[model samples]
Target: MNARLPERQASRALLIGSSRFSHEGLHDLPATVNNVRALADALTDPALGGLDPSGCRVLTDPTTPQQVGDAIDGVVNEALDTLLVYYSGHGMLNQRGELFLAVETTDPDPRRVHYFGVPMGWLRSALADSPARNRILILDCCFSGHATQAMSGTAPAVSGNLDIHGTYTLASAPAHETAVAPVGAQFTAFTGELLRTLRQGVPDGGELLTLGDIYPALTRALLASGMPRPQRLGTGMADHIALARNRAYRPATPSTVKPRTVSEPRGTTITPGVRSTNEQDPKVAAEFHAAMLDGYRRAKKELNYNAGNFIQMVQQVGGLEAARRLLRASSVSSGFTTLWEKGRLDLAVEAVVLQDRFAGLFSDEELDIARDRLAEYGYSPAQTS
Candidate 1:
């Protein structure tokens, strides 16, 4: 079941690509061109699963920077519910810390170069002018630091310190480093990872992947790919901001499966009649249990709670199962109760996995109690006899 937020309207995105430039001077121009087209193709491709191409409006291979700016102007002017601007090309930084797109101009002098690219200042201003509540800007080009530098001063102006409501800028690399492109690939490593995660969909508490869920996955995937880690500029609260504004973003939600229950006896301390067994590392199980308790406490205080958050914390402690039961136990909206119940057995397995981790941390009696509680919830421990 797709979790529905307050808003039900489909979201709109604007994809802009500048591959063939009028200017012949920039290095790696061909790669930049290809990457943008590749990114557009990825977004439009149905195989990616989550993102629907019907929601996106793409503009590729703009010959001039003005054409790029014009494309953005048209999208923002429409005042769509959600606006995403993606640019892959050359970026330049001036002495004043201003970032510009390398645009086409007759003058070629490096000192007085007419930066043909759209100004970071103008992009931000355009977002400000738009009626859309969520504005996302992704830049995959060289010398992109200026983009962040331009938006730094405005970060504080956003509500709740979240960047998603305003103009959120994601750069391919830091200011000092150069963005890299692989042969035949259209996008840089960082952009590719970002697209992959967004397309793959994140695992939210139970099959519901939110914008927040995708961010970490994207970050981890990019780093794991052994590519240049893109620098995320602007406020770090983009996802939160987007959610707060009720924008249309897709979430990945997994199907529910029934849980199998198992029971055992207490042998050593508690009741002298408990035995437990499971396939999990004892130390990891203990840590997973501790993390769940800690996360529960934190969630209660924040009043900003979700079963997925707890599930994620538990998984971090051990594995997927451990997180599932904690999620079932936690208070969820009525719509999600059936999902939790169906997956109860899987959650039990997770608890057992965590119990194994806790074995070494607690005394025999404590272990028995933990094991019993898990059993009470339908998780069967490994056979000791």
Candidate 2:
């Protein structure tokens, strides 16, 4: 029998990623930013993890341990069924052989690390004390396997006794090995595979995905890719807990399956680097219009705008129509910089219009305008599209 999905209202997840570090020795990891955001989206997706948006919290480039600790405690206090904590960044080992997760302000020096870095022992204690029945810790960083070493009895005595009763710990690499963050990639290699597994799902699998289902798959995929094999430590029924709905599940009746024609046009031939001009079916068009409006509203709130200029444009012309007009304009829009500053250039009308799923909805010229405008703001077609 497959494991059960966590109840949406009773579960909480905290996703933390640090891309930039203040210490001179730690190089920036631009991909970590994308990792957290994409994972948050996947976890909160209605058809995937089914977690409520409010329950999935994301912290990018957190500066201090207290900030992360507070966020973790906040969720741990609220979660009744499941509590998941994920971290992606540099993992450091101090002189005493204790593992620490590097934050933006973390110093590499052994003495200073104790004060700046977030200790893995702290997380162990929190998980041990958490009231949630199911606890999960996924660490994607160098030396992350040390976090689970306590379970094997090779770690410090204090850490060995700190293992939680009902927890599943998944580390990206072995204790001494460094995790891969491929150059120019959208995510760290380990997390990229994790996201791919969630998005693509296991073929011919059960209705829901359990840790038992995902762990072996990840091991095989990572080894085949020549990446480091992951390490997992599960206590009690942790492996039986479902994390996501299987996307690849098929029913007995073929006719009952909905065709995926809405997201990708069936007969349309689109050119490379250019959007197709084909008109969509009414249902598809209506959905695209709604998404455009929704994206606009989110951008307004994210930008914290009180001025009605952009809102008026969107209201009068409709979001998609306004996007069409914006794409055709020669000058960059005023809101582009602010959106970019907030790491939400994706919310900009120009970027939103270029989504891959909306490939056939816009013309080549209009798409070019969107692409060019985004290029001026430092987004390449690969990043925007």
For model 1 the TM-score comes to 0.55
The best candidate by TM-score is: 2
Instruction: Please give each candidate's TM-score.
Output: 0.55, 0.64
Candidate 2 residues 1-385, lDDT tens each? 2368888999999999999998898999999989999999988898886789999999999999999899888888898888999999999888887789999999978777878999987777777788888899999999999988854445864534644556888999989999999999999999999998888886645677777667766776898899998888776556667789889777547685333322334567766545555544665566667777777678667666432455677778866677777665423344553465456777777766667656577776566567656665566644322
Q: Assess each prediction's global lDDT (C-alpha) against the native.
A: 0.50, 0.77
lDDT of 1 by residue, 267-361 (tens): 32222323334224465455556655654444445434344544554557554344343334312222122122333432332333334333333
List of clashing residue pairs for candidate 2: none
Candidate 1 error regions (>4 Å):
1-10, 22-24, 31-34, 41-55, 104-110, 113-115, 154-167, 202-209, 233-237, 240-385
Per-candidate clashes come to 32, 0
Q: How far off is residue 261 in model 2, in Å?
A: 39
